[model samples]
Target: MKILVINGPNINMLGIREPEIYGRETYDDLIAYIKEETKLLNIKVSFYQSNHEGNLVDKIQESYGKYDGIVINPAAYTHTSVALLDVVKAVGIPTVEVHISDPDSRDEFRKISYIRQACVTTIKGKGFKGYIEAIEYLVKHHS
Candidate 1:
Protein backbone atom coordinates (compact mmCIF):
# COMPACT_ATOMS: atom_id res chain seq x y z
CA MET A 1 0.00 0.00 0.00
CA LYS A 2 1.06 3.61 -0.54
CA ILE A 3 0.83 6.28 2.12
CA LEU A 4 1.46 9.99 2.43
CA VAL A 5 3.06 11.37 5.55
CA ILE A 6 2.49 15.07 6.13
CA ASN A 7 4.24 16.99 8.87
CA GLY A 8 3.67 20.65 9.59
CA PRO A 9 5.38 23.71 11.06
CA ASN A 10 8.40 23.36 13.30
CA ILE A 11 8.36 19.57 12.91
CA ASN A 12 11.54 19.95 10.89
CA MET A 13 13.11 21.07 14.14
CA LEU A 14 12.35 17.79 15.91
CA GLY A 15 15.77 17.29 17.41
CA ILE A 16 16.89 20.85 18.05
CA ARG A 17 13.60 22.22 19.31
CA GLU A 18 12.71 20.38 22.49
CA PRO A 19 14.76 17.43 23.68
CA GLU A 20 12.59 16.84 26.69
CA ILE A 21 9.32 16.75 24.83
CA TYR A 22 10.13 15.81 21.27
CA GLY A 23 13.17 13.66 22.01
CA ARG A 24 16.74 14.09 20.77
CA GLU A 25 16.17 12.42 17.43
CA THR A 26 16.59 14.70 14.46
CA TYR A 27 13.92 15.10 11.82
CA ASP A 28 16.09 13.05 9.50
CA ASP A 29 16.16 10.35 12.14
CA LEU A 30 12.41 10.36 12.28
CA ILE A 31 12.19 9.97 8.52
CA ALA A 32 14.78 7.21 8.55
CA TYR A 33 12.87 5.36 11.21
CA ILE A 34 9.61 5.59 9.30
CA LYS A 35 11.23 4.51 6.06
CA GLU A 36 12.91 1.60 7.73
CA GLU A 37 9.80 0.46 9.52
CA THR A 38 7.56 0.74 6.48
CA LYS A 39 10.11 -1.05 4.31
CA LEU A 40 9.62 -4.12 6.45
CA LEU A 41 5.89 -3.89 5.90
CA ASN A 42 6.38 -3.57 2.13
CA ILE A 43 4.64 -0.23 2.16
CA LYS A 44 5.47 2.70 -0.10
CA VAL A 45 5.51 6.02 1.71
CA SER A 46 5.96 9.61 0.58
CA PHE A 47 6.79 12.43 2.95
CA TYR A 48 6.05 16.16 3.00
CA GLN A 49 6.88 18.73 5.64
CA SER A 50 6.03 22.41 5.53
CA ASN A 51 5.88 25.32 7.87
CA HIS A 52 3.25 26.84 5.63
CA GLU A 53 -0.39 26.03 6.20
CA GLY A 54 -1.38 26.59 2.58
CA ASN A 55 1.28 24.18 1.38
CA LEU A 56 -0.02 21.52 3.76
CA VAL A 57 -3.58 21.99 2.61
CA ASP A 58 -2.42 21.80 -0.99
CA LYS A 59 -0.55 18.62 -0.29
CA ILE A 60 -3.64 17.04 1.23
CA GLN A 61 -5.68 18.05 -1.80
CA GLU A 62 -3.01 16.66 -4.11
CA SER A 63 -3.16 13.28 -2.36
CA TYR A 64 -6.57 12.59 -3.78
CA GLY A 65 -6.71 9.43 -5.95
CA LYS A 66 -2.91 9.22 -5.62
CA TYR A 67 -2.47 7.83 -2.14
CA ASP A 68 -4.14 5.04 -0.22
CA GLY A 69 -3.93 6.75 3.14
CA ILE A 70 -2.44 9.75 4.97
CA VAL A 71 -0.56 9.97 8.24
CA ILE A 72 -0.51 13.61 9.31
CA ASN A 73 1.12 15.36 12.20
CA PRO A 74 -0.25 18.82 11.63
CA ALA A 75 1.75 20.12 14.59
CA ALA A 76 0.37 23.43 15.75
CA TYR A 77 -2.16 23.40 12.98
CA THR A 78 -3.94 20.46 14.58
CA HIS A 79 -5.57 22.75 17.09
CA THR A 80 -6.62 25.39 14.59
CA SER A 81 -6.70 24.78 10.85
CA VAL A 82 -10.27 24.32 9.73
CA ALA A 83 -8.99 24.58 6.19
CA LEU A 84 -6.99 21.41 6.71
CA LEU A 85 -9.91 19.64 8.25
CA ASP A 86 -12.05 20.68 5.31
CA VAL A 87 -9.57 19.46 2.73
CA VAL A 88 -9.14 16.14 4.49
CA LYS A 89 -12.86 15.77 4.53
CA ALA A 90 -13.15 16.70 0.90
CA VAL A 91 -10.42 14.28 -0.14
CA GLY A 92 -12.29 11.48 1.62
CA ILE A 93 -9.16 9.39 2.07
CA PRO A 94 -8.50 7.45 5.24
CA THR A 95 -6.37 9.66 7.50
CA VAL A 96 -4.62 9.23 10.80
CA GLU A 97 -3.64 12.23 12.90
CA VAL A 98 -0.45 11.91 14.94
CA HIS A 99 1.04 14.01 17.71
CA ILE A 100 4.38 13.33 19.40
CA SER A 101 3.24 14.89 22.59
CA ASP A 102 -0.17 14.39 24.14
CA PRO A 103 -1.89 17.69 23.55
CA ASP A 104 -4.38 17.18 26.29
CA SER A 105 -1.51 17.02 28.76
CA ARG A 106 -0.18 20.36 27.60
CA ASP A 107 -1.68 23.82 27.54
CA GLU A 108 -5.44 24.16 27.50
CA PHE A 109 -5.28 25.62 24.01
CA ARG A 110 -3.56 22.51 22.76
CA LYS A 111 -6.38 20.22 23.84
CA ILE A 112 -8.59 21.28 20.98
CA SER A 113 -8.10 19.65 17.58
CA TYR A 114 -10.15 20.62 14.56
CA ILE A 115 -8.51 17.88 12.51
CA ARG A 116 -9.43 14.99 14.78
CA GLN A 117 -12.98 14.77 13.57
CA ALA A 118 -11.73 14.44 10.03
CA CYS A 119 -9.34 11.58 10.79
CA VAL A 120 -10.03 7.89 11.12
CA THR A 121 -7.89 7.83 14.23
CA THR A 122 -5.58 9.98 16.32
CA ILE A 123 -2.28 8.72 17.76
CA LYS A 124 -0.69 10.87 20.43
CA GLY A 125 2.06 10.79 23.10
CA LYS A 126 3.92 7.95 21.44
CA GLY A 127 6.58 10.18 19.92
CA PHE A 128 7.95 9.11 16.56
CA LYS A 129 6.53 5.64 17.06
CA GLY A 130 3.08 7.11 16.57
CA TYR A 131 3.82 7.66 12.91
CA ILE A 132 4.69 4.03 12.45
CA GLU A 133 1.60 2.97 14.30
CA ALA A 134 -0.56 5.09 12.04
CA ILE A 135 1.13 3.65 8.98
CA GLU A 136 0.58 0.13 10.22
CA TYR A 137 -3.05 0.85 10.95
CA LEU A 138 -3.66 2.21 7.48
CA VAL A 139 -1.88 -0.68 5.88
CA LYS A 140 -3.88 -3.22 7.82
CA HIS A 141 -7.23 -1.48 7.88
CA HIS A 142 -7.47 0.87 4.93
CA SER A 143 -5.83 -1.46 2.47
Candidate 2:
Protein backbone atom coordinates (compact mmCIF):
# COMPACT_ATOMS: atom_id res chain seq x y z
CA MET A 1 0.00 0.00 0.00
CA LYS A 2 1.16 3.49 -0.77
CA ILE A 3 0.29 6.61 1.17
CA LEU A 4 1.02 10.24 0.46
CA VAL A 5 1.41 12.67 3.33
CA ILE A 6 0.92 16.33 2.56
CA ASN A 7 1.55 19.26 4.88
CA GLY A 8 0.65 22.85 4.11
CA PRO A 9 1.32 26.52 4.91
CA ASN A 10 3.60 27.19 7.86
CA ILE A 11 3.87 23.54 8.81
CA ASN A 12 7.57 23.62 7.95
CA MET A 13 7.93 26.02 10.88
CA LEU A 14 6.48 23.52 13.29
CA GLY A 15 9.13 23.80 15.95
CA ILE A 16 9.35 27.57 15.89
CA ARG A 17 5.84 28.67 14.89
CA GLU A 18 4.00 27.95 18.15
CA PRO A 19 5.70 25.59 20.53
CA GLU A 20 2.90 25.87 23.04
CA ILE A 21 0.28 24.46 20.69
CA TYR A 22 2.25 22.40 18.20
CA GLY A 23 5.00 21.27 20.56
CA ARG A 24 8.73 21.59 19.80
CA GLU A 25 8.93 18.89 17.18
CA THR A 26 10.62 20.05 14.01
CA TYR A 27 9.05 19.11 10.67
CA ASP A 28 11.82 16.53 10.22
CA ASP A 29 11.02 15.18 13.67
CA LEU A 30 7.40 14.78 12.64
CA ILE A 31 8.48 12.90 9.52
CA ALA A 32 10.76 10.65 11.54
CA TYR A 33 8.02 9.90 14.03
CA ILE A 34 5.67 8.89 11.26
CA LYS A 35 8.33 6.76 9.60
CA GLU A 36 9.16 5.00 12.86
CA GLU A 37 5.54 4.26 13.60
CA THR A 38 4.83 2.84 10.16
CA LYS A 39 8.14 1.07 9.58
CA LEU A 40 6.77 -2.31 10.59
CA LEU A 41 3.47 -1.90 8.79
CA ASN A 42 4.97 -2.58 5.36
CA ILE A 43 3.36 0.42 3.76
CA LYS A 44 5.12 2.67 1.29
CA VAL A 45 4.87 6.24 2.50
CA SER A 46 5.89 9.51 0.88
CA PHE A 47 5.76 13.06 2.19
CA TYR A 48 5.35 16.53 0.73
CA GLN A 49 5.08 19.95 2.34
CA SER A 50 4.41 23.26 0.66
CA ASN A 51 3.40 26.74 1.66
CA HIS A 52 1.84 27.29 -1.76
CA GLU A 53 -1.77 26.32 -2.40
CA GLY A 54 -1.24 25.59 -6.10
CA ASN A 55 1.70 23.34 -5.41
CA LEU A 56 -0.35 21.38 -2.93
CA VAL A 57 -3.18 21.10 -5.44
CA ASP A 58 -0.71 19.88 -8.03
CA LYS A 59 0.59 17.28 -5.62
CA ILE A 60 -2.89 16.01 -4.94
CA GLN A 61 -3.56 15.92 -8.65
CA GLU A 62 -0.35 14.02 -9.18
CA SER A 63 -1.29 11.51 -6.50
CA TYR A 64 -4.26 10.37 -8.59
CA GLY A 65 -3.55 6.71 -9.28
CA LYS A 66 -0.17 6.61 -7.58
CA TYR A 67 -1.27 6.59 -3.95
CA ASP A 68 -3.75 4.46 -2.09
CA GLY A 69 -4.42 7.01 0.60
CA ILE A 70 -3.49 10.47 1.81
CA VAL A 71 -2.80 12.02 5.21
CA ILE A 72 -3.04 15.76 4.94
CA ASN A 73 -2.49 18.67 7.28
CA PRO A 74 -3.64 21.67 5.31
CA ALA A 75 -2.59 23.98 8.16
CA ALA A 76 -3.82 27.50 7.48
CA TYR A 77 -5.41 26.36 4.26
CA THR A 78 -7.67 24.03 6.19
CA HIS A 79 -9.92 26.94 6.97
CA THR A 80 -9.69 28.66 3.62
CA SER A 81 -8.85 26.52 0.61
CA VAL A 82 -11.74 25.31 -1.43
CA ALA A 83 -9.26 24.37 -4.15
CA LEU A 84 -7.82 21.74 -1.83
CA LEU A 85 -11.24 20.31 -1.10
CA ASP A 86 -12.07 20.18 -4.78
CA VAL A 87 -8.82 18.56 -5.86
CA VAL A 88 -9.02 15.92 -3.18
CA LYS A 89 -12.54 15.18 -4.26
CA ALA A 90 -11.48 15.04 -7.87
CA VAL A 91 -8.63 12.68 -7.12
CA GLY A 92 -10.97 10.36 -5.23
CA ILE A 93 -8.20 9.27 -2.91
CA PRO A 94 -9.12 8.14 0.57
CA THR A 95 -7.84 11.05 2.62
CA VAL A 96 -7.44 11.63 6.32
CA GLU A 97 -7.10 15.20 7.49
CA VAL A 98 -4.64 15.75 10.35
CA HIS A 99 -3.73 18.68 12.57
CA ILE A 100 -1.04 19.03 15.23
CA SER A 101 -3.30 21.26 17.27
CA ASP A 102 -7.04 21.03 17.68
CA PRO A 103 -8.70 23.58 15.51
CA ASP A 104 -12.06 23.15 17.16
CA SER A 105 -10.60 24.40 20.42
CA ARG A 106 -8.93 27.38 18.80
CA ASP A 107 -10.42 30.51 17.34
CA GLU A 108 -13.73 30.49 15.47
CA PHE A 109 -11.95 30.72 12.11
CA ARG A 110 -9.84 27.69 12.90
CA LYS A 111 -12.95 25.67 13.55
CA ILE A 112 -13.67 25.59 9.84
CA SER A 113 -11.98 23.07 7.58
CA TYR A 114 -12.61 23.34 3.85
CA ILE A 115 -10.86 20.03 3.24
CA ARG A 116 -12.64 17.99 5.89
CA GLN A 117 -15.65 17.49 3.70
CA ALA A 118 -13.47 15.50 1.29
CA CYS A 119 -11.64 13.44 3.88
CA VAL A 120 -12.55 9.98 5.07
CA THR A 121 -11.55 10.91 8.63
CA THR A 122 -9.89 13.69 10.58
CA ILE A 123 -7.30 13.48 13.37
CA LYS A 124 -6.20 16.42 15.48
CA GLY A 125 -4.71 17.57 18.78
CA LYS A 126 -2.59 14.45 19.04
CA GLY A 127 0.67 16.17 18.16
CA PHE A 128 2.99 14.33 15.77
CA LYS A 129 1.32 11.09 16.75
CA GLY A 130 -1.73 12.19 14.82
CA TYR A 131 0.10 11.47 11.56
CA ILE A 132 0.69 7.94 12.76
CA GLU A 133 -2.96 7.52 13.54
CA ALA A 134 -3.89 8.80 10.11
CA ILE A 135 -1.45 6.52 8.32
CA GLU A 136 -2.53 3.46 10.30
CA TYR A 137 -6.14 4.24 9.64
CA LEU A 138 -5.49 4.41 5.89
CA VAL A 139 -3.53 1.16 5.85
CA LYS A 140 -6.19 -0.63 7.84
CA HIS A 141 -9.16 0.77 6.01
CA HIS A 142 -8.12 1.84 2.53
CA SER A 143 -5.41 -0.69 1.86
Q: Over 4 Å off in model 2, which ranges? A: none
TM-scores for all predictions:
0.98, 0.98
What is the clash count for each candidate, in the order shown?
Answer: 0, 0
- Alpha carbon lDDT of each predicted model: 0.95, 0.95
lDDT per residue as tens, model 1, 1-143:
88999999999998899789999998999999999888888778999999999999999999999999999999999988999999999999999999999999999999999999999999999999999999999988999
Clashing pairs in 2: none
In model 2, state the lDDT of residue 38.
91
Query: Candidate 2, after superposition: displacement of residue 120 in Å?
Result: 0.3
